[model samples]
Target chain A: MVKSIHIEKLNYVYQSGTPFSRRALTDVSLDIKTGSYTAIIGHTGSGKSTLLQHLNGLLKPTSGSLTVAGNHITSETKNKELNELRHHVGFVFQFPEAQLFEETVLKDIAFAPKNFGKSDEEAEQVAAKMATLVGLPDSVLDSSPFELSGGQMRRVAIAGVLAMEPQILVLDEPTAGLDPKGRLEMMEMFEQLHQEQHLTIILVTHQMNDVANYADHVVVMENGGLIANSTPERVFSDPDWLHKHHLGLPQTTAFAAKLAKQGVPFETLPLTEKQLAEKLAELMPQSGGELHG
Target chain B: MVVPFVYAFNILNLYFFMFRIMVLLILKTKFERERTMDGIIDIKDLCFRYSQENEKLDLSHVDLHVNEGEWLAVIGHNGSGKSTLAKAIDGLIEPESGEIFVDGQKLTEESLWNIRKKIGMVFQNPDNQFVGADVEGDVAFGLENQGIEREEMHIRVKEALQVVNMQDFAKHEPVRLSGGQKQRVAIAGVLALRPKIVIFDESTSMLDPEGRMQIISLIKQMNREEGFTVISITHDIDEASLADRVVVVDDGKIMGDSLPEELFQKGNELIDLGLDVPYPQRLKFELNKRGIQTPSEYMDEGSMVNWLSRSILKN
Candidate 1:
């Protein structure tokens, strides 16, 4: 697999060399293996969003280098090539649906590709394909983007990004306020997009359960720096550090903590309740001592 | 025995006179005192639509009386008008045809300022709501706007930051905070206003799961410890499950208003409204179909385990 991103010593100072200057990311470095499902998890103000922005050249790093999917993200890069790079690495922002303002949902999704001078005939077909990818019906083609429900609008907006046929898909808080089912579907879509499309998927989220079940790699950021980078099982295994940063463990971890007090030592800390339940069932007593309760 | 009867008769007559007076007084005071509580955000046949001649607001025969110190969760899908209702209450939008009474003063043009002071709103996008360059400055914005005294403003800013546990970030720039931290500062800004009621308009929607948890936990603390009434607008059914009462709005009207368990019982109706049940609620419902017993209060994680353990033990 090709290495999609190779960022080296990237530094971003908010005010830059002034009295008010604050270093958002200091000497940060990471690389993305093409088609990997990576989650960037962090507390508020961890520069997680800032780092993601750098990935797509949305925000230029103050010093050092960033090469995403293939283009170098620096002012020295030619504008034409940089624009093409943007076409390859899609950035779906939080509340992306709010960016939709076109008359119809179909046109809204087609806007990005059409901006690149794709023929209207070609744009419409791409839009329909993208719409299906995000679970939107063909009927939504004529409905006003603003008139659709929030979840539908969110999906429509995502379809808009997918319509561009980006090789690298980056989403910020894609399922922040979604219901359980919606969250599950959104995460599954991430896996599907990565697996089926061979897309390098970078998801920025605070959901531990998602990080637990889906992400191939998890990166945690705190205090304007990347602190922990590991697999979901390893990251969630030591949730104390997460808690110290004012981050919360998944409910299953907390439940395991409770059982620890009851003399039932959890063999492992499970981030999802299903895992916790199954683990418990496997550890259930065949014949126990006196019931203490 | 004859002497006792004479004293008892006099006392009995005196008690009867007071009882009649008390009955009339209580009846007279019922609605009047209830109106005086700074509670009861009353709306009358409230209506608002983006534009007229295009089938204006479909709301009405509508009535809701939120008591002081109560936490009410409003749940709905996009375009369900939950936000529109919040906007009306916050005076962001005027009801096209109808009236609102906040603490007894109708939301007339002249009374809106006062009503707004009583209700502090936190929007979904914490970034846009931020007006300060730094954390301390941001929290102080609401206080400064209210023209609070300089020294008092400093004290209030500190207190509000402490309330959301963002005191350490006081000197940090608002732009530098994490998605969750920025939200806490935004909430602190509202807290400095000392509003009687705080409306969280899905404020955590822009945050990650971690950020979302911190924000809500702080909000709960504020509501419980600070004695402020809270109205939360949420799409997360799990978050809605934590609320005392859940009001489900659908297609611009109230579809269900009850405790979370009761509302979730209307399974298909809720699904049709574009909402999903919380995890345990869904699990319990599914378990019931399979002859497994699960109670509603077990809807929470810890309690669910305790219930399951005991039930399994009994068998």
Candidate 2:
């Protein structure tokens, strides 16, 4: 029951004291368990990104407090004092490929580690290991990152973050802009990391299917406030609330709901395609092609 | 006798020249007919390569025709050359071989600027498209580039903003707008140009779910109401499902071209092309595996719901 991250009454206002001042997050509170996969879902400007920025001390809370990976942060926290916290919290920004700038893929991946005081040789070694972990071939390690394809560039950016060997990995729409196959592969890589490497994952995504399939816990945000914090099943059980917030249900959950309205018996909603298939199979006849459309 | 033979050879040469001219005239008419076959954009065996070292052409002998007022969705995995085809159509990059015709005008160096005016492209990143200080300024940037008068630019910019429902944010800076609003502003920029065709190059890929829906609806409105032909290049199957025709590109070639409903039915082929099968189709596949027979034809969410309810009620 170790809490990897805990936020209490966190508030953030952008451009405070100016005419353009706006409150991004208002007294939000949440807890993320260590080694647990958590998905954050909300509309744009819902303070999801603002809250994520606070996890690694990218943005300090205007009021209240947060403790992430044993590092305490508040408005009083200085930029220079956040080095230790950042080491344990890795952030993969949206369109991360745009962030790659090194001449070679290996150099780009090794940049973060070398910046954190690792020797050149040590950083390169770690970078190579992380690159392979992210499915990047060694042949391209010496090549310019700009020469790689979009999907490969994304992997290099991810390997750069993984080179830090952080305990908590935060991803902001990591699969955005990728093809369906690439999206699936990227999601699977993160899942493998979460299960095998035991890394705590916090993902901000618009994809409900990713939430239902991968996340154990879900957090919902609306208008700069925390609305719901619970398991995926509890959060998605009521479709009305999600729709009201301009959110959507996972395909399987939505399909199950449609079936439920037609007098199909269900103890609980199926969250995944496999679960839906199993549930429908029990009610169906063993013979194939017997029922008329 | 030899003088008469030379005279006959000269006469034969004249006949051959006349026959060649006649054939050329016929081919010219046929080519023009194909270019104007109600296709606003026609690409014929287009081939392009990024560099000499590139082993395969970025766009390899690709032939695609987009009908007037049609919403065409081009989908492919990363580096599959779907974007290259779009760039070729826009004249952003010159192809190594083959021809492209937009609005029946061939795309060449001489016609590049004129053809560009007819096609407006919204790229993946809205931030990159911004060239002005505020929303209104951004929308008017294109018109300004064309030497439009200030008063006329103002009217058109306002109208474009009103169409995207971004009129209220006319004074808002790009930094202040949400992702969806930024995209709307980008669309307004395209709309002010009054282009015949609008290319959404993975425009919704950077947006959230609600933002994506808003942009998609706006594109649909433009295509249906305003009579603008749409060419959307995307990776989202759901978005592609909304198009009138879906073209699957794999490895610099068109793998499948059909209606979205018919295309989704080829489940394994879509997966092989690095695309996704729609949710309803995936559900059908899962059900069929467990000895429950589902229809072979593709079913969207609504039809799938109806079929599921009907079958379960029968049992």
lDDT per residue as tens, model 2, A5-45: 99999999999889999899999989999999999998877
Candidate 1 chain B lowest-lDDT run of ten = B290-299
Residue range A37-79, candidate 1, lDDT tens digits: 8989876667888898877677787888889877887645555
Task: Output the lDDT of residue B110, model 1.
Answer: 89
Where model 2 places Cα greater than 4 Å from the true spot, the runs are: A15-21, B1-38
What lDDT does model 2 reach? 0.90
CA lDDT of each prediction against the hidden true structure: 0.78, 0.90
What would the per-residue lDDT of candidate 1 be over residues B267-290, giving only the tens digit for each residue? 545655546654555445644554
Q: How do the residues B1-315 of candidate 2 rate in per-residue lDDT, one tens digit apiece?
A: 899999999999999999999999999999878765759998899999989898988888999999888999998878888888888999989899999989989999999999999999999988788899989999999999999999999999999999999999999889878788899999999999999999999998888777888999999889889889999998778778889999989899998899988888888668666578888888888887887888777788888888887766776
List DockQ, one per candidate, in order: 0.27, 0.47
* TM-score between candidate 2 and the true structure: 0.90
| TM per candidate | 0.80, 0.90
Best by DockQ: 2
Model 1, position A146: C-alpha lDDT score: 82
